[model samples]
Target: MLEEEYQPRRVAPAHLRRTEPPEAPFEFAIRTARQSDLPAIREIYNHYVANSTVTFDEDAMTLREWKQKFAYLDKLGMPFLVAESPSGQLLGYALVTPWKPKRAYRYTVENSIYLGPAASGKGLGKALLAELITASKEAGLKEMIAVVADQGAEASLALHEKFGFTEIGRMGKVGYKFDRWLGTVLLQRSLKH
Candidate 1:
């Protein structure tokens, strides 16, 4: 066959190209986290630690550290939740820790949520946050605070706000990461009616 016979005279412009519809939201169930879920949770969190400024930690957390945290939260009666697929795969996690180390701050807690890259943008974060908030309230927590990074964490900020967290304050140049100064946006929601 002649080479010229196989060539197309024109090609569709990028704008005219067809694209598939967005995928339906992935299905997952949100429930209280168990000790077995820490490995997956650590993987999700360390992704942000190593690749993004979502968490200020410059080092990856070991499984032992996660277990220590799990025990601490369990002892304190705090909420540590996970989202899982029907097949038992870990999708994401959300948890609450004491906002401060003082007894006076016992009624206030800070929340952290992390989703695996593939699990993001599919309603898992929202589901985890909703379950976390309910669990926190049931645990007698009065306030839930979210300390979201100012950079590369817009989705987190929006997710927290969607659950009624309001901007309480912002701190600039408080964290140095990836060879740049990073900041944090503080948000708080009252768990009590």
Candidate 2:
């Protein structure tokens, strides 16, 4: 197991802002997630759970469950972001969660990024993850982890690699979903402080 110190710090909302806008007039903006965005976030996530191997979960999350998750992250002050159009349509989201609940693992967090089908390949995933890492560093996180599903999630893996993450471990047949067993790849990226 990996361990690091917990030195929580305040992350300014501005640090989570997107510095560069999309070249095309995509009518989208990246910003911190709000409570109201939970429904759309759930929809996007559930769509993946039901139709793709992006997530290993077999069931969709309820609104209350999503709200609870958002509240917990808010209290912990972890980074959670949303990609939205100017007219308030949610396009995608990215966030981080504790790698493990033990105190020794506090500085290590796992990252997650999800994009709506129509929003993929438009730089939203990259932009959102870049901001997530920046915010995690600002919050004094030492390591970011990605627990990837092994069923052809290349784009997600590539995104992490582009951000300097390296494959640290892989467990075969650790997850069973979509009527088949799947592997889990652990990727790690250290934020040297």
Candidate 3:
């Protein structure tokens, strides 16, 4: 897969600029994630692993780990979804896993969503999260949790709030990455069947 590049389009002078707004860069379709999609999914995730504090993990996930995760979620009947373009390039992915390993927490899950660099600022995250919520409801999950980064994840916080997630708590300086102290904001949404 080629690395996504930013190509700026030439803009007309203000006098000649069109009054209409521009359309999104591309359209995408959301579907259940297949084992074959793991590579692209891994690429999208590693982009964050290498560059951002959105995820606290310092090491990039290996494909073997992704396959294991896919298998585990499949066995548990959890929702794992991917957003693909018309030409079939994966744009992003979202999934939910058991919030805790104990039996009493079976009905609760933690949600995660990641998009490629080029896919941000579009409505893809919203679309993916909406589908994830529906899928989670169908899977009999009663609650969804979002652990968002306190510093660089404002958009993530807003997206979860748009879906009715409420801020439940926060942990200050709980993580250290990139030679700096970071924190997490905990948000939760109740899922109704």
Candidate 4:
């Protein structure tokens, strides 16, 4: 997969003028992730793994690990999605992860959504989350949880809130990334209950 170079589009004080119409204005589609999409999905995820506190994993995920995860989620009949751009670029992804390992927690799942920096500030995140919520209900999940690793995750936090998720807990100083401590924000919404 080719990583598209970022280009500034809108007119800016004459200094940022190269965003021409050579490439089509961006558009994306929401769809279920497939085995073939693991590489693209890993690209978006590991960027944050290497650069941000959005995820607590300090190391990038290998394709083998990703394949295992795919197998696991598939066995649970959960939804894993990807947002593909008009040019066939994967702009973002959202999925339902098991909230915990306990047998009784099968009805509850955690939601994780991430976007490529180029896709930031767009409504793609919202659309993806909405799709996951619907998919979760259809899969018979009773509750959906979100465990955010950053207190500054306003975009993610707000997106979940806008979809009826409510804060249920918090864990302070649970992560340290890029030389600073970060907190975890817990939020939830009932899907079938």
Candidate 5:
């Protein structure tokens, strides 16, 4: 069921922003998406699409398509976020999109985060994910879902787990990419309070 519409946090343009480094050196400012960040986001997303099973998409997305997504998010008022280096480089991004189109799913969202190669293993994932969850909860979402694919989802899984998301189900060999069968894991965390 979930494998059918495994859309990532699909979005487009954001305003570019710069900020002073936080007291913690590892912390980067997580801000709403900027138009400038989309290319960097696409570069990071395309890396996984082409080289790993992070996504089932075999082809990279074009810039125009990315812009269209941003437009759609604008219409929905969905949140799209990006991390910026003090010097203004795009370090990573996380965003939430509707888990499904039906009105019944309005209080639920699916999240996706991608970090640049240079940004990996530096606790950036933790920071970005924490901020994303906070924003999602504040936006009135009652549930958060993470749909993680087999090969490159380990860090994502651990990050979500660290933040209190629990594994709810696993679908075996539900995808195929890079010439082999692939799997997907679903994790859930509730914000129903």
Candidate 6:
């Protein structure tokens, strides 16, 4: 694994750029996250924590926590990708992390996807998920899991299903947030060769 800084190169043509404006519902690009993206990522995540059940976290993570997460991902040699518009506004991010700390669990990872409010319903989630899945496979992972907050997050469940994830387990009332207990659904997708 290289520690070199990764830069995203423009792959779309000029006409395509005009045809697909970043703010438009259909425009998005998936690229590796950079240090400069921390602010936008924090804002998007905070919005969900403050208003949605997608994440069971009751409070927004501080900058230190976010930095620690980034460092851990780097140590794992996993990719953390951000969805952005052509103008470089981050709309979402997706990544995979170790499912368990044991060395025996090295081949298994957990998948995570998060989006800005404006990025919903535009296929950005699907795009990011597909890319993350492919990247995980290439990086030699054998299985991917999605641990979803089970307040009936239908869209997330459906998206994972579309990518061949199956419900493996469910924990009732394992997370407490928003003054209520939330269930957790564990979905798994196998990529073993």
lDDT values for all models:
0.93, 0.90, 0.95, 0.88, 0.85, 0.87
Q: How big is the positional error of residue 116 in model 1, measured in Å on the Cα after superposition? A: 0.5
Best by lDDT: 3
Prediction RMSDs, each to the true structure: 5.2, 17.9, 9.3, 9.7, 17.3, 14.9
> Which lDDT tens digits does candidate 1 get at residues 1-193?
8878767646577798898999765788888899999899999999989999999999999999999999999999999999898889998899999999999999999999899999888888888899999999999999999999999999999998898999999999999999999999999999996
Clashing residue pairs found in predicted model 5:
12-70, 14-33, 14-34, 14-35, 15-34
Per-residue lDDT of candidate 3, residues 143-163 (tens digit)? 999999999999999999999
Candidate 6 to truth, TM? 0.85
In candidate 4, what are the lDDT values of residues 1-193, reduced to their tens digit?
A: 3344433433376765565558655689999999999998898899999987889899999999999999999999999989999788889999998999999999999988999899988789988998999999999999999988765677888888899999999999978877888899899999974
Which candidate's TM-score is highest? 3
Which tens-of-lDDT digit does each residue in 38-126 have in candidate 2?
99999999999899887998999999999999999999889999999887889999999999999999899999999999899888888
Candidate 1 vs candidate 6, TM-score winner: 1
Those runs of model 6 whose alpha carbons end farther than 4 Å from true positions after fitting are 1-25
Ranking by TM-score: 3, 1, 2, 4, 6, 5
lDDT of 4 at 50: 93
Q: What stretches of model 3 exceed 4 Å from their correct place? A: 1-25
Model 5 TM-score?
Answer: 0.84
- What's the residue-level lDDT of 2 in candidate 4? 33
- Winner on TM-score (1 vs 5): 1
Cα lDDT of model 1 overall?
Answer: 0.93
- How many clashes (backbone N, Cα, C below 3 Å) per candidate? 0, 0, 0, 0, 5, 0
Task: Tell me the lDDT of candidate 4.
Answer: 0.88
Q: Model 3 Cα displacement at 48 (Å)? A: 0.2
